[model samples]
Every structure is written in structure tokens, then in C-alpha cells.
Target: MLVRIRGAWFVAVGVVVAVVATALLLVTRAGADTDRCTRFRDAADDRAGLVTGVGADLLVIGDSYSVGLGVGAAESWPTRLPGRVRVGGFSGSGFSRGASPCGDVSYAARAARDLPESEIVVVEGGLNDFDQPAAAVEDGFERLLARLDDRRVLVVGPAPAPERAAAVPAVDALLADLAREHGVGYLSMAEADLPYLDDGLHLTVEGHRQFGDLVAGALSTARQPGR
Candidate 1:
């Protein structure tokens, strides 16, 4: 009888262990699936028909700064840009090699795939590359511009940060050189007078308005006649 009891106890423990292991495996799988789903959903939402019905012949691509951080989509500079500009920016996006926080897609790859053939292609991104080596930043920018081919590109330099304003000039100069080398237009928002930049990085609502106006002025001058 004691032998039978021992056997039963062993069986019960084995079953319990198996159940716990299965539960753990299932939980892990569910978490991974959830993460992949979230990434895909965010990418899909970001890539949704932004240019539809806008009559945009221009495409704008960049990180949160270019998208008008802390502001609604309507208040973005691309939205406010004259001649129906379509915006293809994602927040927290960088020109890094690893998986993007905004999505699983690489910024350069996404730009090549999603960017429309436009007379004007505004490429803005660099702040996120602060920690990365300057070579990496330049390489990413070069790759992005390579995809533009003969298209008229505009490389908007980084914004001014009170802590980094001194360094801003060098970064802006690099971007300017890149644009010139690629034969594209360049806009330096770092020189613009925008008092609405909170924390010297992201823009406030008023800042967004000011950026939109700045972009509008640039586009007004750059846009093809009657466009």
C-alpha cells in the first residue's frame, strides 16, 4: 500500500510540473506574438494612405522632429507645406541598423519602398543618431539620399537644443554638405526663430505652427510654378 501511495504522489508531481511548464511556454509564446503584432500594427498604421486625397506631389520623410513632435498630424509642417505635401514620418524613428522602435522596418528601406516619386523629397533625421558615430549617421543619410536618385531632395538639419546648440552647427554643416553633394535643397530649421520649442528639442503647439509657417515659406518658393 505504501508503494502504491508513493507512486501516486510521484505521478501527481509529474503532472503538476508538466502543467506548469506548458503554462510557461504558452505565456512566453503569447508575449512574443503580442510584440510582433504590435510592431506590425504600428507599421501598418504609420504607412496608411497618408497621401490619398491630398493631391501631394511632394513626399516628406523623417523622425519625430520632422513630423512635428507633440502636435497633431494636421499641425505638422508637411501637412502645412504648400502644394499638397504628404508626410511619411514616424516618431522615435532613427536611421539605425537595428529594428526601429516605431516598427520592424528600417527607415531607409521604408523610405525606398513608400516614398512617392516627387519633385521634392524632404529628408529629416539626425537627433536620434546623436549616440551613433558620425560615420554611421552620414552613411544612413547617404543611403537615404541614394534612393532619391535625381529627385530634388531637401535635408533639413537638426533643431537647436540649449545643451547641444554649440554642437548643432557641426551637424547642420554636415547635413548641408550632404545635400549639396547630392544636389538637393537644404533647409536649416536650426536657424529659424521658434520660441515654442519645449526642452529645446520637441516643439510645442506654437512651435509646430511656426515650423509649418517656415516650411510653407520654403515650399512656396521651391514649388514649381502653378503647382
Candidate 2:
């Protein structure tokens, strides 16, 4: 009968539509996974470059916080840093070995070997050293600065943790003294108005932009004809 024929046609059309829809869903999911995998691989490759010795004008050294995990390389503050800045920080790296379960390489040693003779050097690590004594952090920092000689240094202070911000003042003071002794400038994340912290720690996309602006301003001032 005509009714039976029409019913079969409708069922066939519905099946075709369902198959197409399922295929689209799978394709979309696969694309997303591929993108994530690509980002991971890119980050890993960048780290390898650092370990193998790639020098740059402005070397940024730090840990995961500096690595800008979950954020693109261009969105990282170091990459965004103006006036010839380059990335040297590896994800999960710290100032001293055993500082973090993920960190083994010494940031200072990496900088000494990999950084070129540049006017500016930005060092952004210390949170991992918080559990350790202040003296240890200071000593490690001192060694790093000594290697830089007279190159302008900007020691980036840690972000504001709900509880850790209280200790930042003391830490900032110590960092300031160190900078003065070495004739280097220091910049603190606490001083910058960070409305873009992803989780009270890492800078969000907007935060990275703002932080980059601050770094540029500092570099400009330091490199001014007079001061």
C-alpha cells in the first residue's frame, strides 16, 4: 500500500539524518582533542629548546606560573613582554631542585648558559621557595644576580594568594634590597592591578596583557636617555 511505502521512506530519511548528526559530533570532539594535544606538544617542544640552549635578549625564568599553563605561548607575560623579551621558563621549573615535585632544573643555571648579553633580564620565581627559609631564597637570588653583572634585572614578585599576600610585603622588601645592592630594578605582581588572575595565581588572558604593559613601561623608563 502507498501508506506502507511512505512510512518506510520516512524511516530511511530519519536514519540518514541521525547518522550525519553522529558523524558531525564525532568530528567536533576529535578536532577539540587534536587542538589540546597540539598545545601540549608545542609547550613540550619549547621546553626542550630551553634545555638545549637557545639564547634570547630578554630571558624570563620561572616555574609553571611563569609557563602560563592552559594559556597560549603568545598570551604568556614573558612572550608578551615588550622590548625584545623571550621565554626561558619551563613549565614546573623552579629556582632550586626539589622545590616542586615537577621541577628539577635550576632556573639560574639555565639563564646563565642560555641568555645573551642583553639590557634586561626578568626573573619571576619564589613561590616554590616560600616553604623554605627566606635566607635560602635570597642566597639563590643573589647567585643569579651576580651572574648577570650590570644587566638591568627585574625580579617579578609572586602573586597574591589569599593567605600568602600577608608575607609578600616582607618578601618584596627583601627583593628590593637585593635589587638596590645590584643596581637592578624590581617589579612586583602585587603592585600591578591584576583583574585577570585565572585562579588567584596565574594571569588570565587579560591579566597577561596588562602585565605586559607594565613590563614595557618599566623597560622604557629604565632605558630612558637620562635615568
Candidate 3:
């Protein structure tokens, strides 16, 4: 059983053996401004896994979708970023965990207490929060963005999955509004040029690769002068 906790893998294994994802993280907060990285790495042992360390000023956080659960290690958009980036996040995480069975900590809490410094931070998570009241998630999301202060943040809404087709738009709208309010970038994954898998919860490797390019383009345009 997959516990609704950060760094805990939740993929329902159906075969005798399966590959374990290496893009996992465990962070602990100390004081009001210290987020120590407990663990974050790719499963290099896996045939398709890739090893990449974090040190760059780019941080990406979100749930299993953003963690690239269904794709190869290097095929993940985060791992495939054009430049070096400090990637650290967990699957099953979201904006805020109310009665949801997906996460125990809100993305806002994680951002406020357990994130490293970065000029650009891409946050993508809201599927778990979609069932909850929008206002509640908005509250946490606002605080999350506020904590970043001067940092540039890009809100990547939940990917367009068959399961979330009907409900993701609302969350995406909410994020778009927040992006405007905070003068940040909001990339609507719903409109992203990608394809989904059979489960409809994850994206294909080609999809991720293409999405990575789109994300890179959006980030560049969003960072432009008077864009």
C-alpha cells in the first residue's frame, strides 16, 4: 500500500518485479529558513534510470505526475531540462492535504519550509487538491508563492490526464489567476503538447520529452522583458 506521504512511491506494482523510481526526495525543515535535503536522486541502478545531482538554482516540485512516474529517468521533463537544475520533490503531494488521501503536507508548507534557493522554481501539483474546496488550496498556494518572495516561480498545472479531464480546468484557471496576481508564470499542462498513457494518469516518454521543450520555451518567454 502506498502511504499518502512525501518520498513514498505509490505505483501499484502488477508484476513479479518492477523498476523503482529514483527521482525521490525527503526534506526536513529546521527553523524558519532552513530546508535540509535528506535524499534526492535518480535510480541509476535501473536500466533506464539516469543519475543527476542537484546544485543549480532551478527547483521543480510537485506530485507523481511531475516526478515522472511512468517515464524513464532521463525522459522526465525535469531531468531533461535544457540546463542544470536542482530537482527535488515527491509523488502524491499537492497544494494542500485536507481530507485527501494523496498527501500529508501541502505544497505551500513544503515550499515555505522545505525548499532551497532558486532563481526559478517550477511547481506542479493540484490533482489531489481538486476534490477539496478551491479557496483552501488557494490559501496555501498564495502562501507558497509569497514565501518565494523575489524568486521567479512557474506554476505548472496538473497534466491533461484522462482521469482529470473534466476537473483540471478549474484548478488550472485558479493557478492562472494566481500567476497573474503574483506576476509569475503559469503553464497550463492541459494545453501542453503531449500524450497520455493507458492509466491516463501519467505521460509517455515522448510526451514528457516534448513537454520539457514546451516548458523550457514557456519559461523563456515568461522571463522575457515585458512579456
Listed in order, each prediction's TM-score against the native is: 0.68, 0.65, 0.69
Over 4 Å off, model 2? 1-56, 94-98, 196-198, 220-227
Predictions: Cα RMSD each: 7.7, 13.0, 13.8
Q: Give the alpha carbon lDDT tens digit for every residue of 1-227 in model 1.
A: 99999999999999999999999999998888678557544644554445433565877777775555566555565666656566777665556544254343446777877776687776766556555566766677777766776666666676776645776777777777766665666778668766555567777777767776776566533322112
Q: How would you order the candidates by TM-score, starting with the best?
A: 3, 1, 2
* Winner by TM-score between candidate 3 and candidate 1: 3
Query: Which regions of candidate 1 deviate over 4 angstroms?
Result: 1-48, 51-56, 96-106, 163-166, 197-200, 220-227
The all-Cα superposition gives candidate 3 an RMSD in Å to the true structure of 13.8
Clashing pairs in 3: 22-43
Higher-scoring candidate on lDDT, 1 or 2: 1
TM-score attained by model 1 = 0.68
Candidate 3 stretches with Cα past 4 Å from truth are 1-56, 99-103, 221-227
Per-residue CA lDDT of model 2 for 1-227, tens digit only, reads: 89999999999999999999999999998887567546544674574354222344666677655566656565666655654555666554445554544333566666666766666767776655656566766667766766776666677766664445676666666766766666666677666666545355566777777776676667643321112
lDDT of 2 at 111: 69
Highest-scoring model, lDDT: 1
User: What are the lDDT scores of the predictions, listed in order?
Assistant: 0.65, 0.62, 0.63
